[model samples]
Target: MFTRIASALLVAGLLATTAPAAHAQTTAAKKAAAAKKATAAKKAAAARTAATKAAAAKAVAARAVTPKAPVAAPAPLTEAQASAGVKEALNKGIIKAVQFASEPDGFNLNDDIHIPTPPDLEIVKSTVGRLPGMGLVFTQLETQLNRAAEAAAPKAKDIFLNALANISITDALTLVTSGSTDAATQFLRRSTQSQLISAFHPDIEAAIDQVGAGRAYATVTDKYNKIPLMTPVNLSLADYTTQKAVDGLFILLANEEAKIRKNPAARTSDILKTVFGR
Candidate 1:
């Protein structure tokens, strides 16, 4: 009976020890599971946060990529505005020098502008002296023709100013750069020829009548036309005045070009400032 009691006590002690070890292992497994759950929760939160940021960034980029509307163009210049621009260039001494130089005195005084009496007229002048009273008639008629041209000088300025007003800024720039002194004159002839012809025709006719150039021109033309087989040349005072007006304009424009190259006053306008200023 005592042996039996000893074995039973030993068995009870073994059971107590085994119970504590098993309890310790169970506690450790539970703690590990809880830790794994916490780690997963943290990872899931970080992934959500990263995804949200990516979506926000994508939205901002899309907004930035949107295109804006285009701007409108400016209006074109009006006729009045264009005219004013041309006139501004003219009002400055730039083109004025040309006008002054294109007058009767401008050409008559400058050896360059003279329309030489036809080489044939020299024979007429020499023969007139041998023919007594014919000398005075020839002299009077020649003098009168020249006087008529002098009388017509003032009209040229009027024609030039009118032509200048019509000059386009595009044409003006072309004239200022690549054009000769006669560029402006050529432009005027092309642009203002019809208008000037209209404006000067009546005035030229009246001047011819007043100067008595009509009779002299007719007599000379008649005498020349009567020469057998020669091209019947009927020269009119009006026609001469028209040709003179064109010649005078070029002479004046050349003078203007000279002034512009030398004088500061010629480049006084705003357009000139832009075009000519350094």
Candidate 2:
């Protein structure tokens, strides 16, 4: 009976000791689980924060690469302004051309526009030029022809003005903003070359007759024809001189027109300063 009592006491002591140890192990397990869960939650929050910061940085980078809107352009030129500007440019250029052409050396000295001896008179000129005293006679004929044309240049002003007055608003606009350096000259050329030719031909004939160029040409041709084996030539001196004279005037006009297109200082008129400067 004593042995049975001792064994029961020993069993009870072992059970109490084991129960406290089991409880301690269970509490330790619960604390480890809680700490691991908290660490996982912290890591998840850090990952979410990093992802949010990266997303924010990407948005900022996108904004930096975007282009800004452009500034607005100024208003268009009014129709009246365009018309006035075109007329003003044309009138200025034409006036300058007429004034220059009216000068003594206008066509005679300006080699670019100087009328050569009538091409038909080539053989006649060469033949006569060989004659001792007639060496400069052909050159004199060319000068006399140019002088006649110079005398006829002022007449173009009135004809050009008349033509400009006839130009429509659309035509005026086309000339003003055409971006062409020769716009004014080309416009005048189209409007006036043929008309000026007609107006100039009779005057050229009278002027050449008055200036004695016709006599000079006759002298040269007569002398050449008398020289054996040379063919006779008859060309319209009036036609050649008149065309060349008009061409010279337009060449000068084109120069003036270019100044308006390229040089701010050349835009002297109020309308020119306003329209082209902008």
Candidate 3:
């Protein structure tokens, strides 16, 4: 019985040591499996990143090699076209200017072209204008002067058109290609100003008389002359009105020409667009 008990205790000690060794081996095997799975996942992620980079590079290369479509140049302008366009633009400007200047209160209300007291009458305005009731005479005269200008504005359209008709083809081409905004207007002014003054004087005189501007001027000047120690003021109302009226017309014409030259919307006709677009 004693020999059997000792053999049984030895068997229990062997089981305890062997059981711990078996547990350690199982834990080591599980750790090795987890490490291998982590390495496989890292390699898959690296491959996907590489594939995305390759796709972006390929797209950039494709775009770099592609050729874009070319743009077409504008058609060349002919001399005939330039001439016609210049005339058309001038005609449009002239018509609008005449219409604007001829309207009631056109010259009087427009600060840009409004005729003020004449330079010769400056002393009268400075001295006599300070007087009660005398100041109104100057104001009335100025209003009537502008009114006369408005009445005479329509007569200038036919004369302006006639002058435009005589512009040579070379001159028209020069005007079209001059690169100056008011080149056409300047040309008209230089060529037609003298003729306009001569043709417009009688009309302006009649208009001034009809509008009572002449009487207003006489009344103002008469009052100024009656003032003690004042020099007699003498100005030809007809001459002054004619010159100022022509100047006002040119001012309006230049503005219109500038619009046609610089603004695309002002190019109303095909001829204007074709010539001025360039």
Ranking by lDDT: 3, 2, 1
Give TM per candidate: 0.51, 0.72, 0.78
TM-score of candidate 1 relative to the true fold: 0.51
Over 144-198, each residue of candidate 2 has an lDDT whose tens digit, in order, gives 9999999999999999888777777887777778878898678778878999999
* Clashing residue pairs, backbone N/CA/C < 3 A, model 2: none
How many residue-pair clashes does candidate 2 contain?
Answer: 0
Q: What does candidate 3's lDDT look like per residue over 80-150, in tens digits?
A: 98889989999999999999999998899998899887999898788778778877888889999998899
- Top of the candidates by lDDT: 3
Q: Model 1: per-residue lDDT, tens digit, 1-278?
A: 99999999999999999999999999999999999999999999999999999999999998999886776653454444445543554444334644454445554455555444444555544543455455565655555544445555556566667667667767665655543544554666677667656766677677667877677656555565566776655456576665665565556555665565456676666655444332
Misplaced by over 4 Å in model 2 are: 1-72
Q: Candidate 2 or 3, higher TM-score?
A: 3
lDDT of 1: 0.60
| lDDT value, residue 245 of candidate 3 | 93
Q: Any residue pairs clashing in model 3, and if so which?
A: none
TM-score of candidate 2 on Cα atoms, chains taken together: 0.72
